[model samples]
Target: MAKITYVNADGDSTIIDVANGDSVMRGAVLNGVKGIVAQCGGGASCGTCHVYVDPENTKPLADMHRVEDELLYFTACERKENSRLSCQLPVSEELDGLVVHLPEKQL
Candidate 1:
């Protein structure tokens, strides 16, 4: 299992324990973490599941696929180097204590 911390725009944090192979977006939705709408589920079609991964914790993540890369441009907030669609980020032991910063909105 891995523990992921999601920090909202206002600095509120929701920490969830997730199993390996579960997507970060799925973890948030399951735990009722705000700011992750996941409108398209884990399909990577909608950008509403956007999150800014802490730079230091990004090394373990797989490279973004073309679909997720393209969809990120449509997110509700400014895109950053650390920006990622939580739907595309699967959990793993290497990502324990991962920190994901939520955007101002996920609409």
Candidate 2:
């Protein structure tokens, strides 16, 4: 399992373990990690799972794809250079220490 850290807007953080092949959003939802709504259930269309990947850890994440890119435009919070949909980030052993920052809202 890969360990991922999720930091909320209020600065509270939780670390969850995710199995390989599972998306970051899945780990959060299953663990009850606050901040990621994941209303579309990992489908990439909802933008509800939007997160700001810690800049230092992004190298291990998948590159932004068209679907995520377009949906980001509809996020409920301000988009940043590190903005990404957690559902699009698959867990892997290489990403064991991945850290992502949750946006203020996901609607």
| CA lDDT of each prediction against the hidden true structure | 0.91, 0.92
Q: Which lDDT tens digits does candidate 2 get at residues 2-89?
A: 9999999999999999999999999999999989899889998899999999988745778889989999999999988899999999
Off by over 4 Å in 1: none
Tens digits of per-residue lDDT, candidate 1, 53-99, equal: 98777548878999989988889898999999999988899989999
Model 1 scores a TM of 0.95
Measured on C-alpha atoms, candidate 2 has an lDDT of 0.92
- Whole-model lDDT for model 1 versus the true structure? 0.91
Over 4 Å off, model 2: none
Best by lDDT: 2
